[model samples]
Target: MDLNLKDKKALIFGSTGGIGRSIAEALIKEGASVYINGRTIEKCKAIAQEIGAAGFYAGDLTQKGIAANITGQMITDHKGIDILVTNTGGPKKGSFLEVDLEQWESDFQSLWLSVVESLQKALPAMSAQKFGRVLLITSLAAKEPLPGLTTSNGLRAGLAGLVRSISNEYAKDGITLNLILPGYTNTDRLKALNLSEEKVKEMIPAGRLGEPEELADLATFLASPKAGYITGQSIAIDGGVLKGH
Candidate 1:
């Protein structure tokens, strides 16, 4: 199916690796001109080169001014973003009691504030164009808490709340805001968790960890021109790991 994303410009954060990289590659394959971001210029450039249809931007989204600067640069080059994929690295695994104030603040800023900053810069142009797709990559933990992911559980829930409110406010203006929750996708991050592949398969009803391409395909659809009516929803691509409605 043609996503109608040919020539659409997308800016993807945390695209150096993992799920973010998957999304970047998928968008490029769908004919979108993508700008990939990472903390290091070399990594971003290397990935962009490998992906073939992407540009590279190296900036620390955790830094106060970096998000604005990247947004401004994208606008200057591409006029504005047609799609924005908000993503970042997950925080260190631990319980709430094990987290300190610094960890809390840092996680909040990286996981939530970075999205806020980028959207603030991109929303006006999106409104003016009368077309926009903002896809936030969150986790199932947002709705179903996990034992060792308190930071993600808390921050992603807040991010979903923000998406819900923004989707309502922006829907009338022809913009769609939504969140995509990816549960146990097969990526480097998941491998780092060190569960045996067989154990992962047993845990998920689908009997396997999800492929990055699977999540990326869904992200491409969400950002497609045909998906305009899907705003204000948090759809999970979790291989039935989340049984809740």
Candidate 2:
């Protein structure tokens, strides 16, 4: 499986660490000209050099206009992007009623609105080129609600609808849009939660946490020309944590 990604230009958000960093590394290995992005310039720069990325972009996605600005800058500088991946940290963990009112707006701004803005700026260019791959790195909470993740559950599900709507409209343009749902992946973010790995493993049929590289490989494949026919779909890369399709 060549994946046929060599020479393609890719821009990935939240690539400084965790799943995003792993995906960027995978794309570079597949020969894509990858651009790493994060809120911290030094971190993104260091990671870009460490992974042999083509470049780096720094901006806080939670702020309005930042994503669009980054996309616009990327297009102007690199001509156009063939693969675009949007990912960010999840909102603070809390149950529905326990979350503060202001937190909802902040979550929407970072987790959802930023993606909307980036796509609005990039999709037209992709349509013109008649070649593109758009991947939204969401969570398994999109399909199944998780305790203490009410914000993620709500916004991630909304992204599924967004992917379906946009994919249908753009497929004729040679652009594919889809979601990759990661469940209990072994990453620093998951480790920071302070949850017992044994307890978590017990809940999953596979009896283990997914590796970051495993999810990264799935994303790399989806971002390649090989996955052109697979669009408007949500694929989960969990360790059989999701009981239903």
Candidate 3:
């Protein structure tokens, strides 16, 4: 199946490693011109070199104005981007009672506001071209709240709502917006939780943690020209961990 992604320009945030890196690799395999982002210039450039990315940006999206800066630079360098993948590191884990105002503000900026800012910066160009794909790499916590991820659960849920509302407004402009809710993916973030593989497998019907590349494949398809009709939906790649309809 041809994704028709050849030469399509993509800008993916948090692409230096992990699931973000996997998605970048998948897009590259489809012959898309990919731009990766990281917080450090040296690291971002190194990953770009390793993956043969079209370019890379060094910016912290948690900081105000950084998303606009990166997207503005992309527009100048590549004319316009065809695909935008919004991803970032997850917030600190804590129970609702343990979370505070400071943590809430920080997490909101990092996980929620950054995505909104990036989309604002990138949407005009996409609307003008009448073609775009916006894929958000959220987590299953957004739908089925996790035990200790109060910040992520709240912010990601807000983001899911935002995606659904905007997707309706943009579908007519030939742009699709959707979210990917990953569950127990094999990544550094998951490892940091110190979850025993055996224990995690027992919880999942698939009896194993999902591979990053597996999620990447679904993400690439969502960002493809062929998935224009699929939007305003939160699709889970969780090995049946979620039981609700």
Give the Cα lDDT of each candidate: 0.87, 0.92, 0.92
User: By summed lDDT, which 10 consecutive residues of candidate 2 come out lowest?
Assistant: 236-245
Per-prediction TM-score: 0.96, 0.98, 0.98
Provide the lowest-lDDT 10-residue window in model 1: 60-69
Write model 3 residue lDDT over 1-245, tens digit each, in one string: 99999999999999999899999999999999999998999999999999999899889977977888898789789999899998988788888889999988888887888888889989999999999999999999988888899999888888888998999899999999999999999999998888788988999999989999999999999999999899999999999998874
Candidate 1: stretches off by over 4 Å: none
Off by over 4 Å in 3: none
How much is 1 displaced in model 3, in angstroms? Answer: 1.0
Sequence-dependent TM-score of model 2: 0.98
Per-residue lDDT tens digits for candidate 2, residues 1-245, read 88899989999999989999999999999999999899999999898999999999999988989999999999999999899999987678998888988999889989999999999989999999999999999999999998888999999999999999999899999999999999999888898777988999999989889998999999988898889899999999888888767
Indicate whether candidate 1 or candidate 3 has the larger lDDT: 3
Query: C-alpha displacement of 87 in model 1, angstroms?
Result: 0.6
Mind giving the per-residue lDDT tens digits that candidate 1 earns over 16-84?
898999999999888899999999988887888988845877998767767777877897888888999
> Can you give the lDDT of residue 49 in candidate 1?
90
Best by lDDT: 2
All candidates: CA RMSD (Å): 1.2, 0.9, 0.9
